[model samples]
Target: MPSHVWNGDDAPPNIHDVYDYIDRELKTLKTKLITKIEKQFFGGIEAIQFLIHIEEIFKSKHRIKRVKSLIPRISGWAELDLFTRTCYEVRRPGGGRDAGFTKDIQTFNAAFQRGIKSLTDLQDELKDLYCVVQTFCRNYQSLEGEFDLKWARETNLELKSAMRGIETLLEEAEEGVNIKLFSSDKFSLEVAETCDTKRYPVLRLFPDLFQKFHFSFHLIGKWRANDQIYLEDIQFKLIKTKRLQRLKHEEYNTLEIEHANLLSIIVEKRVRVKCREIRDRIKNLDQEITKLAGLKRSMMLEKSQTESDIQERKRHLFMNKNVTDIINSKDLDNILGVKKDIEILSKKLKSLNKSLKLNENDLVAKEKEKVALDTDYEDMRKSVSRSNQLAFERTELSKEISIINEKIQELEAIFYRKTDRNKLSQAFEDMKYPAGDDEE
Candidate 1:
């Protein structure tokens, strides 16, 4: 009743069942033998051909026919049985010792065993080569991506830092000015005369004609705003005649003070303008220094990454070289003479690595030099700032001094003319008086 049972009994005992059972067994055995032959012999053949391909890659060919010839041809169960029986006979004691039994069976056994061993060894070698090739290809593929990512990240950080510096500089530039170099109402001017001779009362009343008086004045005030200048007041007043004896000292002093204050204001404004220019220049230099520092940092990071990449590549190349050398020594030793070629290739790779290292070193050195230049630029910028400030102060002081000197000269000239008129008036009065008395 079961699918496997042909009749009602648990086992089929008829002639037909017996023949069917034998046929099924033979078919199963044949399939097994065919599968074995395909897997072992055909697979071994493919492996040998792969080795031949590898040999061709090295540009050499060594004949490997012994292993190839040992593979048995088995198209059906009959040939498979024959091959098995032959193997059994070769292994049996004293079975193939007769003269009629040729040495082909022994040779087949030797070659078959050698082929199996060689196939296994070649498979391992190919596996190693495949692994090395895969690793090398993978590294090559990822190298550029890694470098680009690192560079982008580092560049971004540098850019951010630079942006922050710019923002700070901008904020500082926007702040108000604090320097005040000069101020009004801090100085006074006066005029006076120097006399070397005593004059008569008439000449005193008219000193201009009778007495030659040198007029001069000194500025005697100290600079208060920022301590940039100082002056001490001196007098250069002319002797008055009878007709002009009431000169208003208070009014004249007030006028001179007002003039001096105006001059002080002008000097202050000019100094402020020059100081603004200097501050602007300093701001520009600060921006430049910040930019250079950012650039230098970016270059340093890039150079470091470049060196790391070069070292990684060198290590990978060294590993590849070692693998190539090992494969040449172990697998391709007899097949192709690749040892010398591999050595030469390794040497070339080493030289290339060395060149890359040197290039990276040069770039690093250049970055260092640029950093030094950035420092120098910063120093120069500070010095320029100080120099500009000092120059502004000096220029303003000089202008103030010149203005004071001009005022003093004008006042002195005015005093000289007044003294001369007074002297002429006095002479006229004395002559008029004498003539009137003589006529009486």
Candidate 2:
């Protein structure tokens, strides 16, 4: 709440204190303006004219909704002026935004809103870097379920990352910390034991620097003792231990490639971890799939056997037979295949013979029922014989059709022709008609 102590709770306390003072003064000014207008125009014919003249007192002097409303609105404008000025005091270098333009909390809340908007914009630009940090933060189980996602707070849908790169090079050659000896005095850094901090990242200088430039570059950051991750905070320190040569474009590329290689090594480590997990999952799935497959095969075999039994029951009548008389399945198959037609014919012939004998006796016996039965038996025998003859003819017809097909093919090949009886007769008549014409 002290003046000029801006940015407490990362906000400026001085801004608010100044706003409070300005607001009080504005309230006094409004009261004076209202009173001076009312008193000077009281009880006179020229009072209306006087009031109209006094209406030009403010930015918008037509009317005021309420004393509280008007004063507060005026106070807000004043506060905004203060807020903008305060931001100039502590504004970052090359910073385009001024503060009160953003954090106007008292009157219309313009300052707070615009500040939020700018910070949100910043978050958007750092999306990729934030994403990497988020992944790293998530890797440690301690931070897992308790993360504050800034992207959501800012409503930045694609703001997933932010990255801080640190580069340090020094020339002094030989102690573990002093790996380089330089000719010029400008850039240098020393290697040291790791520190514990949220944002420190560390890198060791490449050996090429020591061999060629007598300078080695090393980077450092705080690391978590438990998590083994580089600290979230990172800074670059170029120690001026000795003079060194400025780097060429190719050297810059080499430095960049080395940094890229370092990141790649970490990424590869993560990939290996992920791959191992995937392999384990695949193995488990394979086992489960194998188990399910075996179960499915078993159920299918049982289903097939049941269906076969049901079909067999429907196809044939199962007359009970003595165990000794019943044939085994293999023997039954052979008997039914080889001798079925002959057995059926023999049985039918015997039945016909018996019926014929009974029919012959029926007439001699002179019984009407017997005669009818005998006629019926004869009719049945004739039908059976006719059916057998028809079946035999069907076989003969099939053979004849096959033979005709072959003959048609042969005729086609030879271009064979046959005489039509009616046409032959007509031709003969034509020939006779010619002879008759000659005679006439």
Candidate 3:
């Protein structure tokens, strides 16, 4: 039957039949997937075709959910419902571009951890068709054992397209298994090929606790070489079904050891989980310390730079104020401005004193003449008063003589000491002076 053309649109395969038949057919195909593909030591058992149908159903229903779920690390990242072969997703809180991505990642991780129940559910989904397919493949392999290469080739040829379709679906199945795998690191590699629908290959690699192992659905396709029966992808995966049970127990112990190991390293007893968690914290500290040191060093460098700038603008303790006010200070730089003002004033005072001395000499020479002129003027004024009858002539003569006597007196006052230049210069110098010194 063409894969797309279901046995009947109206009637679906019994969920049990689907699971069992696929499981049986998977046994042979699983070997083909492993032997043909390049892979590692431990990949878990996978119901390749069953997963493909799950993906198909998922795509038919929640296409976007199915698409987005594909981003997880591997197929095993999700939980399986083996009984119904019905898959659900555990999405990261907010995986895209949002602050919620972090929260979503955490949620996804938690769901993946709870995936154990999902895997066990796979057994419940097997049924009638599973037996038919299993029997059919067994018979085909029996013929092949009898060197029926032509029949085997012709069989593969007849199912080539369907085989390819199954291969394509299997490739997309890993992510369709569950929601948690969205952010989990778990993923599948070296998946099954188109020709191998007779069997299925599943692998699960867990670094923290679970040991890696291979799953094969084959029984009849077992290759016997050198008189030794080499179970390839056929019969069973690299691991025996028996070992899986032991692995589960060991996996739990490993998980405990991992938790205790991490607890010891955490320097805190509250968190009780994987050793990987503690290692992560230690790794985080390495980053934190580096960042802290970088910031501290930067601050120190900035402080030094600021100090250098201050030094460039600093003034001597005593000269700060004066230096700030000076404009045309170049000439005055050598001579203290305060001191220079005093010196300039002293020179002016000395010049004034010399002029005073010359005035004194001139005054002495004019003193006797002024005294004689004053006596003549007084006699003329007395005559004017006695002979007022002399009228206008006498009055005019008296006024002229009085003016002459006033002029002579004015000369004496001018030549005499009025304000001493020495005293003025002394007062000016004393009023404001430079620091630390005072002098004439």
lDDT of 2 by residue, 1-440 (tens): 44343211221122223233333433443343234322322323243332222222221211233322423222122333343343334343342322332232222223223332333333232332232222222221111232233423332222211111101222111112222221122211221122110111101221112211211100000111111211121100011101111223334445455545544544544544655565555555556555555555554555455455544543432322223476799756654543554455445555555554554454344344444545554544454455455456555655655554544343332221112334333433443354447653
lDDT of 3 by residue, 1-440 (tens): 43643231122233223233344444534443344321221224243443454334333323345433543223433322221122223432543532243333333344344433332232222222223333223222221242234543443343333233333333344444332221122333222332121222222222111111121122112211100121122233213333553554455455455545544544332222333454455455456545545554554455455444434334332454465565466635644553454455455545545555554455444454445545544544444343333344445545654544444344333222112344323323333343477566
lDDT of each structure?
Answer: 0.35, 0.32, 0.35
Whose TM-score is higher: candidate 2's or candidate 3's?
3
Query: TM-scores of the models, in the given order?
Result: 0.21, 0.15, 0.16
Candidate 3 — which residues are off by over 4 angstroms? 1-102, 113-115, 123-132, 140-440
Q: Backbone clash tally for model 1?
A: 17
Angstrom error of the Cα, residue 302, model 1: value is 16
